[model samples]
Target: MRIPTVLLLACIPATAFAQQAQPETGSEWEVSSGVEYESGDYGTGTGTDIEILSVPSRLGMTIGRVQMIAAIPYHRIEGPSDVIPGNVLGLPLLPQPQPEADSVTRNGWGDLELGATYALPVKAVNFSLSGSIKLPTAENDLGTGETDYTIGAEVSKAISDKIIPFASFSYTLPGSPEGISLQDRYAVTGGMATWLGRKTQLSASYRYGENPDAAVTDDQRVQLGLNQWVGSGLSIGVYGSAGLSKGAPDQSVGLRIGFALD
Candidate 1:
């Protein structure tokens, strides 16, 4: 459900199966770690600049047609308390609004995210169904202090040897915390990935989503990514994003490395 980010990179390979035979029946494990940084005003009229630095680690397992992932991220946030990381929602009910010139900084582990996706048994194209949950295991004041859930569908096709196009749709139900009312969120993403060679890939994508609060504007963004497989089931990647709406961060960048084993 990570709309034009790491999730998109993960989907590209899944969709590539459209041009080949079914995946072999076996279990594979992967571990990934990355650092992501974002900066933006996030439509906060108070001119409070928000900055977030995150270091995330993920463990994944693929068995037959299903994939499961678990993620934990450490976050350092500096900005107004009303603005939270991850989804970039602006809440008016958060207590203690600092002066425009003053900002508070907090660093701790954020919520734990668990997800699973199943590939449908079809050959015409690659299709999948996925679900994820956000557990309220964050440190105090580091998260919404409530659990969240998301369900989604994705489709993709490998029309040529080098080009793959994909799309995803998702809906999220956020938990309401004390003194705050959150609305449902919906998101859609479309993108294409091109293989430059056996070991290199380039991708571009766009995403649009609704904010969890009706009073806030929607979110829109464009992203570009590059991935390179060095060898022996090890890979590295980098990505950058530009937000087109006030509800999102102005800019963000990330770098990730992953290794897989059968």
Candidate 2:
């Protein structure tokens, strides 16, 4: 099935809301909300302008070495046509022209995701394994309209009292749409984080992904982020990413707010 460009942009994993590599000490609940904005030209040589705005919220609970999270997102997409140049993989090739009337602006709930993670501490490093499912819950071509699954692993180590480095890899099994066949994709991430102060942290990461299908090239992106603890059990963060290849968005920005219930 041909994937929607908006879904590709919305689904690309970012570290904006990722959990710590190591499980927390005790049972805790976290609630988080965030918004993102992205705009780019994605239609082959047509220079078709595409803009996306997304608001996402997640609820998570952790106990010992296990964690579970549920998330929902709202999406608003504006573009020249419902059908874009590339398949679901967000590869910009050549634009197929539709009637001007076919262009539209649409907004709605995108998809629901449920995931679980487990962590193990070995010597000086933490190893984590996670799995997730994306449910089709969108309308107006806002989502893939199919269920997707992903499995991932991560490892992290603290080099110093304030610095931690990590690496992760994941594979996604794509769901088939009515008339299109989808292929599996994989991603890799490497990054480091350091404490700047008692209540502030800074991080940078690079991500690379194999194309989801034969229609697109692979994707590469770099992200920089800062998180600050504003009060007890509450924190806020901001992040930005720049695309390093044609398969990624040109640029994107986002903000997040989170609260933890101890």
Candidate 3:
């Protein structure tokens, strides 16, 4: 089955933190778009392989210390129909692999996510509390077909104006289809970012998450990213991740471009 896709790295708060020490205050707006590809064999030596291609776009605005964001993602899946269900977002929590003869391919819009984050300075650290909801806007089987909620907090501190360290923790409660009981899940992330020059930055992070399905293993991943300011409120970034556990994709890579509007 496909695993839960973690888009935390592409989210507004994470991007802002990587570019600066804290979230921007006052009034600002941003638009970003990116595409990602992931391919892996996930079926515990069953040779069940899947590939996913996704394009996610986001619009965000900051008012005072509050940041609001809206995102939509489109997904395409290719694999054996049994291993990768048609219309399912990526992979189901539990694998329901069918025979190799039932292979299928599907593509469609996924889900919509809306989120808000409130930030404040505490001593030398910038702290943010955020919450989000996922709307079941995709066609049946293309999404969970249920709403999901998440709450999280993040803290970051800068050292000597060149190095920044941050940590975040979040919990998610998912709503599943009838007869399916999905467990609550939690994730933790720790990372550091450093300025390479006046306008370039490099970062690395580790992420761990508890599996929502008892039958599957927990998730572990390591990510490396770079962001460069192209001048005049524009930035470009690239990122890659490798899975450290079976619950995550074997490898993923993506590119993003963002623009700021005052």
lDDT string for model 3 (1-262, tens) is 1100122347222633533533444667777888878766553344656777888888887776677888887878776553322111233443453434343577878788898887765565777888889888875366667888889988877776778887888888888766555688888888887879877778888988776666667778898888777777677888888999887779889988877777
Residue pairs that clash (backbone atoms under 3 angstroms), model 2 = 1-180, 1-181, 3-88, 44-93
Q: Quick one: best lDDT, which candidate?
A: 1
Per-residue lDDT tens digits for candidate 2, residues 1-262, read 1111111113323222233323446777778888888766532333555677878878887776777788787877777645322222333222243333334677878678888877655555667688888887766666667788888887767777778777778888878776554578888888887779866777788988876645655778897777777777777778888888766778889887777777
Which of the numbered candidates is closest to the native, going by highest TM-score? 1
Candidate 1 vs candidate 2, TM-score winner: 1
In order of appearance, the predictions have TM-scores of 0.89, 0.83, 0.86
Query: Model 2, which residues run further than 4 Å from truth?
Result: 1-26, 42-45, 83-103
Relative to the unseen true structure, what is the C-alpha lDDT of residue 130 in candidate 1, on a scale of 0 to 100? Answer: 85
Instruction: Report lDDT (CA) for all predictions.
Output: 0.72, 0.64, 0.68
Single out the weakest 10-residue window by summed lDDT for candidate 2.
1-10
Weakest lDDT window of 10 consecutive positions for candidate 3? 1-10
Over the stretch 89-177, how does candidate 1's per-residue lDDT look in tens digits?
22222333354746788888988889887889887888888888988888847778888898888888887888888888888888888
